[model samples]
Target: MAALHELPSQMRAVYLREYNKPYELVTVDVPNIRENELLVEVHAAGFCHSDLQVIHGQFGTKLPIIPSHEPAGVIVQIGSKCSGPWKVGDRVGVLNFKNACAKCVGCSLSQKRYRNLDPRFCDNRETAGFQHDGAFAQYLAADPATTVLLPSSLSFEQAAPLMCAGATVWGALEKATSGLEPGATVAIVGIGGLGHLGVQFAKALGFTTIALDSRQAGRDLATEVPGGLGPDLVLDSTASDAAEKVLAFTKGEGVAAAVVCTDSIVANTWTLRLLRVGGVMVPLGLPPDRWQFDADVLVFRELVIRGSYVSSAESTRRMMEAVGRSGVRSHITTVELDDVPGIVDMYQEKNFRGRLVVKMRD
Candidate 1:
């Protein structure tokens, strides 16, 4: 963890030395599992925007760590301490935030607020692929605390993205659900990778959903929602009268919730305009700089802003159920494990929707 132990001049290699460099194919031993860990034969791993930030040193994560946090696979081995129903050869999906230390504020049951939410906020947690090694390898040491049994109906390729991207948006939607009545209107802004899934989640929850995005492809993806689950409508967020259209569609009351999946401050600003009085807004994207909002929108309309929250275990199971029922799926572009470098470049250069995943095996 300390800069690869300050390699000597003769041993210093060009890559795998630090962040902002290409990852090399390093032959390391298969990860070993601890008492609470499960040795997962990773069938698939997902690429997230945060993975990009980690590589760029934005999160200040421990350097020289295996990246890609989303892993869906079969359990090849389980530690003796893992006494749940989990067993060898069982299909599974792991949440990135694992190895929860129960005493921390984030993990303590008394901290009801954080208890059901992400464990990544726990001060002492060891996040796979972030604070330490991750799922990019053939086998990852996964914690049972954050691992969920993948539904038999779901394939590993699709299940991998659900581990993060799917759970994240679902978490936001769950927050939005608490603040609304049954079948309220909700708006999903920015229909890219996260937004596309957001649209399905909103629809599956029976909300009168609206999909918004400037990109034609994003708008199109909304209509092409898997299993025909719909947002009910798709509107270009960039239109001059976009807010007006949404307000009129909602009978001037505006949507009950607006989930902003894009990182653009300008686009996020537009979402505030679509919210009715007391409407909640959940922004999932983490932009580099702080978000700027008009104080008047918050004060006058009494609009509420919230972050995504739900028990890592609970959210994964609920998301799996939704996937099973409504057939929600990721529009993933998968690359073999060895071709991750190419996927990294594609994520940066290509304007694509949904997730980029690594297929660890055939």
Candidate 2:
């Protein structure tokens, strides 16, 4: 293995020793890099809603695990078997899936969306934070194949949320925005963590983006784009005339697509009314209960409802490029590693703005 310097034997980490419990701060051994892996000294890791699901026994009991799959940091070591336009000290973000299985989130949509993924990678992989130890620590052993180089201009905190939140939304938008004509319109429903990013991506990807949300903050964030270029319109999903407003915006045809980013069954089911015929609707949230939709709308409109679990490594790189070109950025609130447990409830609140990230070190 190639390394920058003598590595530390131990590091501080947040450990999930049990389900439905607060993560505990503890010391653990720094991971060693494999020939095809990279040892990253994590600078920032994003706290996602999925992380809360993990703690709530959503993915089953994989006890004594480190949380936070959204990892961005400096590569401190590279495995001898790893080769690319990379070396130690490069800033990087790791795709959580080690080797995507067909049933896994990556392969579920990445194969069809990107068409660059291998079927051989389908069905026998471990996912970071779920099946394998993830980046709630100072260091992470990342698979080189699933890692992307980060832009030098982006901070680790800024880049960390993009690893999953940004990539997942970008992947979902890719499903609907592909081949879209110029001036085509898309609506981002529930502009929260992922939805807010979806608005920027849709606008950047050549679609007339319309932001829809129940909360004023989320709707407000939709218009908070850098360079004074925000979504074309913003609507409160909870508004009585929300659906009518969209229909009117698209001249009674509706948007070219509608991405429902909230887990609200109401949003998931109602947003279907806003898609044009043959439009796509990607449910980006993981709701606790089943989501019911109108079957007649599905058959008549031919609306494409697809599942986008996460994005491929190549697609993630594409998203980074979009970030550069569009000046899209995550509205982040940083907290030290030790402060994570205390703020878990804060992120769970409805008024939480932007992403909550853990700043591991300088």
Candidate 3:
């Protein structure tokens, strides 16, 4: 066991005591560092829509859990068994997925190289914030393997979103367009946190980027990208001819691929029509209800539909490097810890712009 700190024994944390309830700030025992874990003094944590899902009892997670999964912090202490490439004071971002049974086939395969026969094979996997304590608190015990060391150039607030949202989009894009040639027409549907990052990434990768969203604000933000690359076209999905508009923008041949970043079934349905023959649509959002698509359209066009889950730690690191080097970054608004509950309510009402980060310390 490590020696106890002579300083404060209790720390402030945002915790939920029950389902469908707001997170409350309370003093709890500082978490103990495990042999493979590092004690991270959390600086900032990003609030994701999935966090709202967990809070609302939609994801089947247990009650009385810490909410934030996108956490970035400084390592205050390291465990006895910890070694190599990390030390005290390292700035890092923590991922939500933790230890898996190494004996399992999925675990044995590296994330970049593995191909599982079944998508549901890893269904029983454990995750932080869902199976273990998460970052909505002042301190988090993060597995060193799951932590991505952030460059000193990135601030904690900026790095927090990369832990989850940034990595997710990056990973999805990598998978969806692995063999994509330069100048391929790519459409990003939604233009929220993940979609916004997806647009920037697609543009950076030399694709002809198009932004699709229903809101004027989203289109406005997408158009303001530096150097005016600003989406080759911005289509307002709310318009009656959204699919036609997209097809027209692609010169009636349709986009080479589309990444569905929203959970809306309507958006998914419309996006399918905007893909050329053999084009792919990668679905990243988790919608509540089931959706259906025309079988003939899929069969005749030979269009591919796939779903992408959260990204791996290695990809997460690459995402951070990409963010550090490019002008593309998440637009975040900082909020204090005490204001999280209210923010959650506002998020439910869909009232905020960009991503929200909880500042754990002054």
Candidate 4:
């Protein structure tokens, strides 16, 4: 148990009191820890577009919930029955999926590799920022099994977004680049939170990275520093011959892999055209509409289309370790916990750059 002095009974939080309504600042009691759980004192939380979708009732969310999934913090209290490696004062961040059942048939099929795809999935799974009360507060109750330790070199602000955005792209990139050579061409479409990270990871893995985006900022960020953390090439998806440009650049062969990070149907459709024969297309973004592709192209080219969600805990840890060692980090804008409501407004308006992390301690 944590000393009473170390924690308060009530903490400040932003609550989604109703669907399609603005968040309200309120004081709520700190969440109780269950067996196999840790009580984390949140240092920082990351605002995700998924949270915005929930606020709009896109996920049919339950009311009066605390939102924000990307949370990094220190463990203050451990449940009596907790048996994992967790301890008080340990730095940790929450994973996208929490409380997954390890006994499902899907778990048996993938041998625990793709439990998130189990038919019985979500029956026992609790998702942070979606199906459960999340980290938009000073404290969060986390499953030790779903929490990742942060490296000493990573700050709370930098580690928060890695829990979700970084992990999602890492998983997608891993799938996209599987069985491909290091020098193979990889295209990251969208150049947003997930897309940007995909570019970084692809570049780090020694692949020639190509970034696809319609925005000048995306093209700019995809340039190598002194310029930025950029790709080897950038394709402007807005151009009439954008697909043709990618094909021409690849000598009419297309890239080895195209990771679609945007939910835009157009962007998703473009992934098929941007890949070489037998190349994999990984779509990680959730657009509000169904993605349409040419069946003839898919059949003739023998292309692969796969959807990747949040990564496994093991993958997340590996990504964090790599980020710490390689100096890979997310571009973030920090805000106070009280600034969450306005942050949501900015997200809806698409006015921010990179990720927005909320500092709860200040």
lDDT of 2 by residue, 227-272 (tens): 6448999988888998999899899998888788888898889998
**What are the per-model numbers of colliding residue pairs?**
2, 1, 0, 2
Report lDDT (Cα) of residue 183, candidate 4.
Answer: 85
Provide the lowest-lDDT 10-residue window in model 4: 113-122
Q: Which residue pairs come into collision in candidate 3?
A: none
By TM-score, the best candidate is 2
Worst 10 residues of 2 by lDDT: 113-122
Q: CA lDDT, every prediction?
A: 0.80, 0.85, 0.79, 0.81
Residue 11 of candidate 1: its Cα lDDT?
A: 15
Q: What is the TM-score of each candidate against the true structure?
A: 0.91, 0.93, 0.91, 0.92
In angstroms, give how far residue 317 of model 4 lies from its true place: 1.2
- Candidate 4 lDDT over 60-128, as tens digits, reads 877778898999999999887775777688998888566657666555665555644432244567777
Off by over 4 Å in 1: 1-16, 109-111, 114-118, 309-311
Worst 10 residues of 3 by lDDT: 115-124
Off by over 4 Å in 4: 1-5, 101-122, 224-229
lDDT of 3 at 15: 85
Which is the winner by lDDT between candidate 2 and candidate 4? 2
Tens digits of lDDT, candidate 1, 133-182? 78887778787778899888899999998888888889888887685787
Error of 1 at 104 (Å): 3.0
What is the lDDT for 181 in model 3?
A: 82
